[model samples]
Target: MEPDQVLSVTELTREIREVLQGHIGTVWVEGEISNHRLQGSGHQYFTLKDAGSQLSCVMFRGARSGVRLSDGAQVQVHGEISVYEPRGQYQMVVKQVQMKGQGSLQARFEALKRKLHEEGLFDQDYKQDIPKYPRVVALVTSPTGAAIQDMLNILTRRAPWIHVLVFPVRVQGQGVEKETIRALEMLNRAEAHGLPVPDTIVIGRGGGSIEDLWAYNEESLARAIFASQIPVISAVGHEIDFTIADFVADLRAPTPSAAAELLAPDVTELKRHFESLSRRLGGQVMTLLDRHEQTLDFIARGALKTAPAYQLQTAEQAVDDLEDNLKVAAKEQLRGLGDLIQERQQIIVEHHPRIMLMEAAHRLENQAQQLQQKISHKLERLADQVTSRAQLMKHLGPESILARGFSYTTDAQGNVIRDAADVEPGQTLVTRLQQGQVTSTAV
Candidate 1:
């Protein structure tokens, strides 16, 4: 126990570790997390601090899998204290982590929100449109709640014609989700059974805490809202309150009365619209009548020619003109016929057979002279062509070819052979000469 008996650095650190580990054993430390680092080895290291002090902490992977950790989050950690031998530093080895108080509820809320978001339940593409003018609004909530009465009052004041069908269900506590889901199913079933189907559905409650309004946040309820064929208007809690139902619904209303206001048409507005439409129709009819009257005036002005006596007089005038035109045309036609007959007679005189024969004989004589000249020209051209052909034949014929010392070979059938491959060894061949062909055979 003297000065010489003092421990070494490692030994001293080890002793301190043992003492702190034994004394602190499995203590609960509440602090805000900072300097958080999650290692690739699945170990999380962080500093847990209060306003006054800070402590190093570590959570090895697989210790608390369900808890999601982040910096600045207030958490209650359950673990034991330990020392890192190399650095001789002490740290809390956390075994379990829990979010504290309202943080806990908020954590769960955010967690569920993230889960539903990842599931595409919060997708706007899947959201339906709320009915603009719902004729039958199906109300799903507590029959005793104030939301239903407010909605009823609003609907009554705004649109007395819209029929509201109420389906009573618990809006909070145990079995609320199940009851709501069951009610939705029942309404859908009724519609499928050919009953009065709701054009729209209103699900809401009065303002309350997140816990009080948690029925609307249930996953099954959100799914039910998404699956509903009838457009859903979610009006849970107050304007400030938001639940999962708000995200999944076809339309989210700030309050129950707001839902009614959205679904119904104001009677005053409708009355104004009706008056405007009636005025427009009256104006259009008056305009149409004016057009008809103008058209009738135009017809009256032009209808003078439509009188029977006027029509008959017009027909008589037309007949007189037609008669005059016919007479003129007949006289002109007779004149043309007489001229044609005179022309035919002149033609007959001019084309007497004797005169025609004389003209024909003169033409025949001229043609005969032309034909003789053409025959002479043709014979001269033929003689030139024959002489040229003879010269070409003299140069190209076999006799000239033989004189040039060139020879061609043919088979006995007189087919000229150009390639040696075309002749077999025993095939009879003829050597074509200018004078005659020489017969040959294979050896």
Candidate 2:
């Protein structure tokens, strides 16, 4: 007889798996990736290592969607760490993986930026050209900071003649969006009131962490920049930094100094261009003067120099003829304009509705007078009928009947009677006139 085995191999494997799974469920493991390889089946196999130890990790095809895993990439994985019975090796089956804390945020930021960029939020066609010679430039940033100082320095160096207007506002932290939006509104109001409008707006701060530069990520600030009538330049954070405002702005510069450079022309280049144009103009003028000198030399040597008086006389007669023609034309034009005005006036008078309005007013007055007469007649008739009815009512009044020495009598049945026979011998009867009532035993 063989020794009795309580469970089969399959059962034992399942039992061991249950125990291992129960003992070690999900855990967060932080490590650096090594030997990362994507399989033909699209699964990822890698070893996660800390300074002292390492564990083999497998990210299945399903869980690896939209995930980019590479060698030497630091990652924190959440999943079950179990022993694989087949290979008898311990490994981690990853459920989710992301770059360690701030790296994870950066990954999400990159993802969002890629998505928005693919949607054409960062298209060059949407970018507006910065004003070449802006009269006023509005700076939206912290009132007191190095960013402002840097921007001011660069602007003064580049465009010292252009006005650098400051709409002092908070660049980061809580309520920054509200204050920034209010600053934009104030600029709009200034424009509405005909104050010098900003030609281009500069909104940014210096380099910092994501949290430190979150104000530019606000949707309100992004929409404000998009809706601005003036062009906007977003220079948020360092060269590697980006925000929604940067994507939506008409232009984005890598730094505040870079933004200043883009906003104004280079003074040296402008001076060079001006000098070149001035030299060209001088050359052209010299060429034209030489030609004129040649012409004068020919004319002095020709016959026209001796006939100056006849030329003067002919020029004077032409001037007089031109003056007379101008006078006659002016008078004719004035007369034509007057006739047109008179014709328009006659048409307006013929089309005027004032005459019809007067007729309507007269008719309204007549109707009102007729209504008044009818209302008065109805009131007089009503008054006469009321007086006649009053007299008739007075004649039928009980007091008038009582004044004629008449009285009304009622028995126990409450029936009014004029004869004593109407009541029985023991019944009580009450008599009523306008003045009083008297009760008596029936006779």
Candidate 3:
């Protein structure tokens, strides 16, 4: 190389930056932190050192390191290796940081999470809906643990009718994942084993450190949960704690007690609901009957009264008596329904309340349909009577009398002259014939 072909300082620095970035693009470095400083702009500047050498690092505000940064702390950093061209110094552009003790475990966790996410294990479309009223639930956990006790207490208090099956297994430590997976498989094929099939399975344990909870993060356990036929609830830790099992399970409850709460409905609330429905149904029936009675009264007054005067009083009395009888019958029927509901409520402990309520409602509906048909038949009969009376009245009308060769005379004021004494001498009159009228003068 000749002196005349020497490189400029700017060119040299740019070439060094390119070479460092191209060769050692990204890396994870473990060291002790020194000279750590946080700027008002939320950027962190620190020096990572060991007994041998030190390296400059900068974490921008947008980077999420998760761990707190301070001098003298042992930490692991992930970033790109690049040179700051203006300063001509190579530094790590930090993207993430973790404590030295958790760095490897956290890395593995992140890698598995990303892999499963890409495989669609966490997709919402794959999630099954947990039954709102699960009839049977299976719990897989340490039988002696507080988690099982809490869940049992909650289930017993909220829904004493539900059947609970407990599968005891180690919730932590080595080979626990195999026990949990086996429990899930057994519950799914429970009928083949002469055990009752469960509507849901809840796998839970109390809160613990990441190491203690590591079994839940196993890929095989997650796969088993994903493949289970029954809906699975993951209640492995506290609210803030999460595991791969949580992601793959059909539903996630923050705690074991919460899982039980989700599965059970309060019996008292259900009873009140049934009672409210009974009352509303009874009230509606009464209202409908009353409206029908009013319609009957209107028909009797308007159409039945048009019959001959001798029959009019008798028809009105009959309609009034029928309406009173209908009212009494409806009241009796409603009273019987109320009594049936009370009796069923008393025996609810022996039979499923839902089935009992449904049966009662179905009977009430059938009775209402029958009553409606009866009312409709009665209305049809009353309408026929009205038609017959209308026809009779038409036949007995003045026009029919005129057609039968009977005629009436009206005086000058258009009043029917029923008797000869109603006319005076020389009074003008009009006599109506069958088809015409004749003007006449009294003689």
Per residue, candidate 2 scores C-alpha lDDT tens digits across 33-128 of 999988899888999998999999898878842236888877789899776778666789998886667555666667766766777767788777
CA lDDT scores, all candidates in order = 0.88, 0.82, 0.92
- Model 2: ten consecutive residues of lowest lDDT: 60-69
Worst 10 residues of 3 by lDDT: 303-312
Model 1 residue 15 lDDT score:
93
Off by over 4 Å in 1: 1-101, 192-194, 304-443
- The C-alpha stretches of model 2 lying farther than 4 A from their native spots are 1-126, 192-195, 306-443
Report lDDT (Cα) of residue 313, candidate 3.
Answer: 80
Score every model by TM-score. Answer: 0.48, 0.47, 0.48
Among these predictions, the greatest lDDT belongs to: 3
Q: Across residues 186-259, which tens digit of lDDT does each residue of candidate 3 receive?
A: 99999999999999999999997677888999999999999998999999999988999999999999999899
Please list all clashing residue pairs in model 3, or write none if there are none: none
Give the Cα-based TM-score of candidate 3 against the true structure.
0.48
Candidate 1 vs candidate 2: the TM-score winner is 1
Residue 384 of model 3, lDDT score: 100
**lDDT tens digits, residue span 1-443, model 1:** 79999889999999999999888788988999999999999999999999999999999988973356899988889899999999999999999887655446767778889999999988889888777777888999889989999999989999999988999999878998899888778787775766588988888889876667877888888898888887788999999889999998888999988888898889999999999999999999999999999988976877454686886788899999999999999999999999999999999989999999999999999999999999999999999999999999988877887977778999989898999989999999999766777899955
Candidate 1 at residue 46, lDDT?
95
Clashes of each: 0, 0, 0
